[model samples]
Target chain A: MSRTKLDLWVGFFVVIGMGALLFLALKVGNLGGSNFTDTYVVMARFDNIGGLKVRAPVKSAGVVVGRVTNIGFDTSGYRAEVTFALDTRYQFPRDTIATILTSGLLGEQYLGLDPGGEAEMLKGGEVVQITQSAVVLEKLIGQFMFDKAAEAPAN
Target chain B: MNGLLNVVRLLGAMVTEAIWRTGFGARFFILLLRHSGQSLTRVHLTIRELYFSGVLSLLIIVVSGLFVGMVLAMQGYETLQRYGSGDALGVLVALSLTRELGPVVAGLLFASRAGLAVTAEIGLMKTTEQLDAMDMMAVNPIARVVAPRFWGGVISMPLLAALFSAMGVFGGWLIGVVLIGVDEGAFWSQMQAAVDFRFDIMNGVVKSVVFGAAVSLIAVFEGYDCTPTAEGLSRAITRTVVTSALAILALDFVLTSLMFRGQS
Candidate 1:
């Protein structure tokens, strides 16, 4: 075979190989999402995080704006300190409510943000004070059963 | 008693020979690395070898990947549809191909295709006294011939594996969304959501690189060390394929355990 032909074929092979890698990174994997945008770390302390794992999505009105960067126990406050990397484009008020919510009856949990009416925007490394813990299904069921039993005699 | 003693003696000799070859192979790899500069500097020699090992193997790799992906989608949809979660087919196909099937299957195919051929070529050179002629002429055959082929296989392997995986994802899309009427939006979205670039894709790349180095080294070593006879050449070729396949599987298991154990 001619030397030029061989070079052409090898060059084609390398290009397609790299193209495959690019496709995997962008289309098949999550590299093309909001990861490219500048993000600010926002901290929230929850009493319970209930299977809210690291890298879980953080959504605002069901739109994913960030991801959970870290989940650790707050030894001083007896709470779970969940750190989020939210996109810089979206700003929430200082009084924004951060709640741990699940997608379905049985699904992975995510952190939901409800922007508050306060004029002050939450800055990087700032903590959102108003936060709700994940709702434990067993605890919810137990409380419901207890309330129902208390009302049985009256009925 | 005589027969039993002969069996034990044979086992002992086999063990010693295996150890000897392993030590020799290790030395050969170190020498190859040291002499690899010549191949790198020349550039074209390595590129020529790449055409032989990588470009030639592309067809088999792509076809096998497609069929595997289609099969996985068909089987996954059958099970997933029972629970009405057929859309997860994309995640299933993508994850399996990128994480396991892509690197492992491609490595296996490469071993049979390129690895065996490399062994055969080098063994023939040895059998024909070409390496001896080079030695007489003060030319280092290891630098001139072996290093280029070794580097070629190593470079071509990861590229081939990546192409295999890309083809696999395409195949799954063809079968699931195009043929089976699964939701296109859900197929792509869920795949993008589930497959992490660093964890899944990067690890697959790492695995392929490791497998490539292993297959290339084993092929060259077997060729260089084979006895100069027709029977010896055939045995060396067989050993190359078997050793490469076993190494790929074992290394994959070890790598997977180390890379993925702590994550939840």
Candidate 2:
């Protein structure tokens, strides 16, 4: 092949190779847990979403069993409505509480479901009445700064 | 006080003259609109340029992305391991690559490699009267010369950015799984759990597209407007690189602000 032809082939393969690698990365990076036979939706209400994006994981007893599928605001309640899909097999009682929790000091927020031992199991579309909203770090920092400023002596 | 006042007056007069004679602000806006139209027209030429800029640069980008990913994963793993949270390596790599490293590094690389070449080529064309020759033939030089490259760069940059992010993630996965002994399944699941398409990848891709347009337009503008002299060509090339690089950074800041504007 001519030099220009060779250059063209090389360029073509480079793009192809890069594209293949990208495909692989996306595939491998997006591997979710094994598919479950039964799943149900759980709803929670929060005062503030607090940087909680959709698809954030929902965990129960530190095990990820679901994910936040959608988030919206309820006009009547004046609160953010977060809906999460959970595996049906992992049954929670009607009295179970859901709280938004962060993994670490600087980590993504996830829904944490605390299962309560009760005879009745929570059904799909049932709202988790006890909900703890997200604790925003910036808000905490701002409050700290405000408190310090208020405590300072007047000049 | 009098001296300062005179200095201020002189500065105001210079600004007024510069704005009027050079038509600085209006010229730039008109140039932007015209170039945008030109860019839209030269689709085929832009594709060819993309073949060069996006495809040809993949090797270096992949190699560099791989090592950067590996290094990031190793460091993150070591740090997280102390807290027994080594499983979070995938999340770390994915978030970092998508948000920051992917676009910025790929943009810098593209600017350094193809950006300078593009400026120099156009500068040479101006210095050698090639652009003038096109003009003599009644060809619109801006449409012919500058538009294709500007559009091409715009098209190519996002592809390269995506390539960079992908390779970097792969590199991170390799280190996390193969080297660090993290389970491949867990590593991937962690990534999936952490990253979302819109927040992570799309953000970088958008930034890349904007950076591409900025770099190419600035470089081509400096080159095409170069004075017909060897010294002028050199100066133009230098200015093109410096100005394009600065524009890339400045635009990135502005774009970031606009993109993340109501979100905390």
Candidate 3:
């Protein structure tokens, strides 16, 4: 192979390979693509968090505004507390409704925020008072079965 | 009765011979590793071998990648349609290609295309006395002949795999979005939301790298160990293909399990 030709092809090869890998990582995987590095952390409490994982997307208006940073048990309240860092660009009112939601019917759980009409704004470390817990599919099915059994005995 | 007894003895001898061959191959592989340092200084030779093994294999890799991706999209649509999630074709195709098929299929293709050629070229040189001539000239053939090709294969494998994956994803998009009636936004957005860079993409790169090392090791060792004869050279080339393919697949399985063990 000619020296220049070899160098040219090798350079092309390296560039394309790296480009594909970067596209797969940043575009397909959405890794390091999140622009929420500089953000504020807020916590919320739920009776059941279900399968809401750390790093799960926190969406507002169906657009990801932040990510779940941590999850812990609140021993005093006997509830699950979730902390998320919301990008400062997307300001939220103090009366925002934060609810746990699953993307698809059987997909990952994320925190969904619905802005409420409030003149005041939420600050960092502030707890969201209005929270909806995750829907426990298994528990719902068990309760449904118990209700059916109870009705059958009464009948 | 005598023939039956002879057959039993032959079987036992064959097993022992296979064990001996494995040991010899292992030693040869270790020697290649030792001589690999010489490859760093022989930049010209390494580049030449890379042209042969890497540049020459691009056409086949790209073509196969595109076709594989197209097929995946078509099949994925059929299956996903039942769930009324046909729009998620991009996610299905991307996940399958990047995580598993991309590295595995590309490694197999690389072995068939480049690994076999390395084996045959080396085996021919040995049979034709070029290697022995180098030895007489006070040159170490392993450093000059084997190490460059080994390095070339190792470097080329991952790049080829990445190219394959890219082409495959494009092919799938052509079919799923352009040809079929799937929602273009859902296909891409869902894929981005689901796959993880560290988990899926990095694991695939790791698999391809390990496969590259294993296949190149098998190829060089097979070529070096062959008897200096026409039949021996042909046998070495065939062995190179079969062994490298088997090694790639087995390594893919072991690596995949380890990478995804704790994942739900």
Indicate which candidate wins on DockQ.
1
Best by TM-score: 1
Ranking by TM-score: 1, 3, 2
CAPRI tier of model 2: incorrect
Candidate 2 stretches with Cα past 4 Å from truth are: A1-25, A28-44, A47-55, A58-109, A112-155, B1-44, B258-264
The C-alpha RMSD of each candidate to the native structure, in angstroms, is 2.9, 8.1, 4.9
Expressed as tens digits, the lDDT of each residue in B6-88 for candidate 1 is 99999999999999999999999898998999899999999999999999998999899899889889999999999889999
Which ranking of candidates, highest DockQ first? 1, 3, 2
Pairs that collide in candidate 1 are none
Model 1 Cα RMSD, 1 decimal: 2.9
Question: For candidate 3, what is the TM-score?
Answer: 0.81
Pairs of colliding residues, candidate 2:
none
Per-residue C-alpha lDDT of model 3 across residues B1-264, encoded as one tens digit per residue:
999999999999999999999998788878888988878886888877788788888899999999999999999999999988898898899999998999999999999999999998899899999999998999899999999999998888888888888889889999999999688899888888677776688888888888888888888888888889999988999999999998888888899888776443
- What candidate 3 gets wrong by more than 4 Å, as runs, is A35-101, A110-134, A148-155, B1-8
Please list all clashing residue pairs in model 3, or write none if there are none: none
Q: State the weakest 10-residue window (summed lDDT) of model 3 chain A.
A: A28-37
Quote model 3's iRMS: 2.2
Native contacts kept (model 3): 0.60
